[model samples]
Target chain A: MVTLNNFRKHYKDFDLNISMQIPAGTVTGLIGRNGAGKSTTIKAILGLINPDEGEVCVFDKNPREFTPRDKEAIGTVIGGNLLGDFITAEDTIAILRKMYADFDEPYFRAQCKALELPLEKPFKDLSNGMKARLRVLIAISHKARLLVLDEPTAGMDVIARSEILDLLREYLAQDGERSVLISSHISSDIEGFCDDVYLIERGEIVLHEDTDTILGQYGVLKLSENEFRDVERQYIVACKKEAYGYACLTKEKQYFVDNYPGIIVENGSLDSTIILMLGGR
Target chain B: MRGVLEKDFRSYRKTVLLTLALVVLYAAFCCLMPGFDLVHSVLFVGWMGAVAAVNEVADDERNGYAFLMTLPVDARSYVLAKLVYVTTVQVHFWILARVTLLVGTLLDGKKPDIPALLSKGLALHFGMVALLMLILTFVIKFGVKSILYLAGGLVMLVCVFCVLVVTKPDANWVDALLRIGRFPHIGIYATAAAIIATAGLTRLAVHFMRNKEF
Candidate 1:
């Protein structure tokens, strides 16, 4: 549903240049650290920023060329409000109902109530968790075909984060054709949700693998220096120095488990993959 | 555009209400208070329009200007909606101003020439209100801080208009509008020019907003 061909944005100290795609009917996660260009990529896809070079296409058309009808299918939550702090959540829902043709008012109000959001409170008065919940609610309230979410769970407690993810899970379950591109600095936030994961570091994609492979097949082999020399090096995706031995990141977790009985193989997560890849040789 | 207009109307309803109260109170002042006349009241109405438009634009930016841009509405339609809302409110206030003036003159035991007064107010405000609305496009682009600078420049212009109002009211630029009404041939030309200018400025505002990053 979204494609970026050599998309590049130039800044004084940071340059974002990457090629990526999110097919329809898939939840793709763009995981990266803060200031790692995740938001920039999402902005380019949403036409919030013009690419300094290359093309960004959504629904097979340049976002800038998208008509109002074209945009109705997209729902985005990029850590911003609909109106300023002056309007209440009720006012926001009213505005959204006017803004979107397919806005499900009953579903939205029910979700708001389920989430314990105060309907009449101004947005500025809402707590951080409430504000976050409200943003996600607005995104899913409309029956959008594509959701481009940038850091939807940035600052929240574990329960709040879980609640936000549950909202997305519920949204995804409602429609098979609906797609999402959720970016975040927290690996665990998108780890269990996304179908495939894209690990970005310093505006570069270090790895792109399905969530199944990352969780089931990938592993980190902790071995002593002498044992590392004896172990197969071909499957290692990344290697890092450690106090006791070496930590090797490999996509073929079962391969090492079958061969190297002495090397400790731990199931790989996005967090370990990022750590090993970025800090490893 | 309807969505954007409705959203703006509801979001900025408070500002509109305050503007309504101010317009009513000012109209009464023009009738009962010494030294408060049509010229002063018209300028004040124009200024109040600026306040309402600027306040709404500021609130939009402070909250989620970027969020609004992500909506189905294109930049052009969004800008057009804002322009329409500002002008519509200003027009309503303007009509109230003229009605108040008419009643005030009639109630004070003066034989008011209703048609002439109405036409004269129309001729004066068409250009005045349009000018203020166009200037307001700057607030939408640069945020509310720009309003202080814009108001400063406008206050200087208002000062000049006040000088003209006292010394050469018949010879001032406002009189040019009255003269255009006297000559229907010139009225068409002036109107076409005004329409072209408003459209051009609105287009320019959209262009500035098209690539804006949230």
Candidate 2:
């Protein structure tokens, strides 16, 4: 649903150069450390910031050229304040109903009730978790075909996060053609929810893999210096030298396990996998 | 565009209402006081419109301009909506000023100079609208903080000019201003100039906003 081709944006201290695609009917996760250009990429895709070079296409149309009707199919939940502090949930709903022709007022109110959000309270008075829920609710309540969520789960409690994840799952199930591009600092949420994941470091996408393949096939092989030297170099996606020896990330876990029985091979979690990939040797 | 206007109106409902009330009270006071001048009373409408315009811009900036940009509306539409809102406020104040002046004249049991009242009112209205358009252009280009500083500097300059005029009433610049004020068709010309300037500044503001990021 979204394609970014050789996108480049230059900041005073940082330069973002990235290229990626978010296919329809899948949850794509963009994982990166802080200042790794995740939000910058999101901004570029949304046309909130102009890229120095390259192209971004959403639903086969340039974001800058999108009319209000074109934008009606896209819902966005950005980090930080999305509305004035004095605006209440009721006010937001009222305003959105006028802004969007397909805005589902009943669904929005129902979601707010389900989330126990006080409709009359100003946004500033709400807790961070409540704010997060409200933002996500608004995004989904617009009958959007594509949901672009930037750190939607940040500042939420465990229960709230789980509820939000469930909501996303339900939303995807409701429409087979719907897609989502979510960026979050919480790796486990991405691991559990994403169909595909992109690992960005210093404004560059270093890795892109299917979540299932990463979970099932990827492994970390810990070895002594001699064993590391003997191991085939092609299987090591990335390696980090440790106090004892070296930790190598490999996609051919079974090959390593079956061939090198003496080496310690463990199933790699998303956090450890990213650490190994981003942690320069 | 309607959505944008509705949001602004709701957000500034209290401020707009209070400003209208204050302007009305001040107009009444001007009419009742000894040596009351309808022309001076009408000038208050301009000041009130200026205050309302500045407050609206300040509130929008303070609230979440970046967030508003993320909405479905385009930048041009956003700028147009703001202009419409300000114009609506100015028009409402203009009507009030005219009505109050008319009622005040009838109450005083004197023949009202309808043409003079209209000329004065039109001049002030157009001038205020022009000033507001310029301010909006600056605010859009340079942001609220820079505009606030500019406004402060202008106020200081105006104060100094007033003091100079009071101290040297016969100075060359002061005499020139007095002569311009006494020009037979000055009001109509001033009004026309202000209207033209307002249109030009509004176009400039729209162009600046189109290029602005966030």
Candidate 3:
């Protein structure tokens, strides 16, 4: 279990006050716009940066308490270059084998083969998608108890993306209690694999719920200006008034669907749902 | 720690090979050149430390190799590994130089100011090594380029001081250093021990570095 308790960090332009719990044995998607504190939150949990307030515990252990052995339990690929670009993939594996007690050479090699990443090539020489795959492969090969990946598919083509997702799903299915936290800007990728999604806007978690619950419960309700004036405003999260009248985000889609027979209500995609929930006003 | 250390060494194979080549080339000069200075060992050791420390510090972070710093490896272990690497190279070159100089002296069938030069050289080398170890530790902790600029500034400052030292005919720098020579009989042994002890101080430096966050 990964618990983020009232985690707060402040910058001159932004403040991140987020709290969330990620259950074990499930893939939790951290969905946010760029600079929405997703990477900052991840960096805090990884101990790359210290938080101003709040605590993070991964598997009941504070990240600050992380020893080499404790770190071996977590595998991660962040947005920035994680490996030294000069090292060949083969050299990287050899070094990782020494750092991780559970590093399986055969598994790493298999992943490389599956991904078709040349072992002898320097990391700088690999294409961005290939590098992303290699990073995932290396992290996964450690047999980590927790996998934290940030934008693992950002540069991947459809074929490579599917293969990577397939590998992640396979890894998740092999064990009943493994956990993963993935952050991506592409809503479709998150919608494809994540059972739950945490939507962050301007450093705050605007919505945290199971993927189906959000997609099923919240929707865009379009209505005429005169019609919206008569409807109760309490249930409308935010409304955009236009020439056609008003398009509002309703917290309870079913209620609007049942109450406003004449209003236009439609199921929203993850991207629009996030946009409505975050930047609706 | 060992894992990261191995990784650091493996990544710098080219640099290591180059340093070794320099050491060999200098050792050859000591053996073949007339008026051969046994200070060859000291010079080689200093060159090794400078090359290894500067190269590692300057390139690692810029190349984005430091992403591994987030892993469970202690920052100090990372720093210590560099110190250990530099010291190891330094000691190897020192021993090789000493052995070569000893062989050259035996073949010449004469004691050629080896005792005096060795004694003074050892003291200066060890003192410089102690200071270099500390400097490199902080360099690894802070940004490397920042350290390089600082080092460059320091070198320019030292160059001015060297000019002063050289121009001052009244300045008895050699005499001042050699005053600590108590027993001329064991001078060679004492010098050897000083060089070895300088290598030992790196352990203290490594301990300090292991606890750092960078």
- DockQ (model 3, Cα): 0.43
- In the range A147-250, model 2's lDDT, one tens digit per residue, is 99999999998899999999999889999999999999899999999999999989999999999999999999998999999998888899999998999999
Instruction: Flag clash pairs in model 2.
Output: none
Model 3, A1-281: lDDT tens digits are: 89889988888998989898888898999999998988877876776655679988887877755777888888887755555666788888878878888888998898888789999988778899988998888778878888888888889988888899999999888887888999998898899899999988888998887888767887788888788888878888767766798778776888888887888887756876787777667
User: Which candidate comes out best when scored by lDDT?
Assistant: 2
Model 1 has a DockQ score of 0.55
* Candidate 1 docking class: medium
DockQ, cand. 2: 0.53
* Rank by TM-score (best first): 2, 1, 3
Scanning candidate 2 chain A in windows of ten residues, the lowest lDDT window is: A78-87
Which of candidates 1 and 2 is the stronger one according to lDDT? 2
Instruction: State the TM-score, rounded to 2 decimals, of chain A in model 1.
Output: 0.97
How many clashes does the backbone of model 2 have? 0
Off by over 4 Å in 2: B17-21, B24-32, B99-120
Compared with the true structure, all predictions reach lDDT values of 0.80, 0.84, 0.73
- Residue-level lDDT of model 1, residues A104-212, one tens digit each, is 9999899988999999998889888888888888888889999999888877899999988988998999999999999988888888899998888787777889988
> Who is ahead in lDDT, 2 or 3?
2
TM-score of chain A of each: 0.97, 0.98, 0.94
User: In candidate 1, which residue pairs get closer than 3 Å at backbone N, Cα or C atoms, i.e. clash?
Assistant: A84-B63
Better of 1 and 3 by lDDT: 1
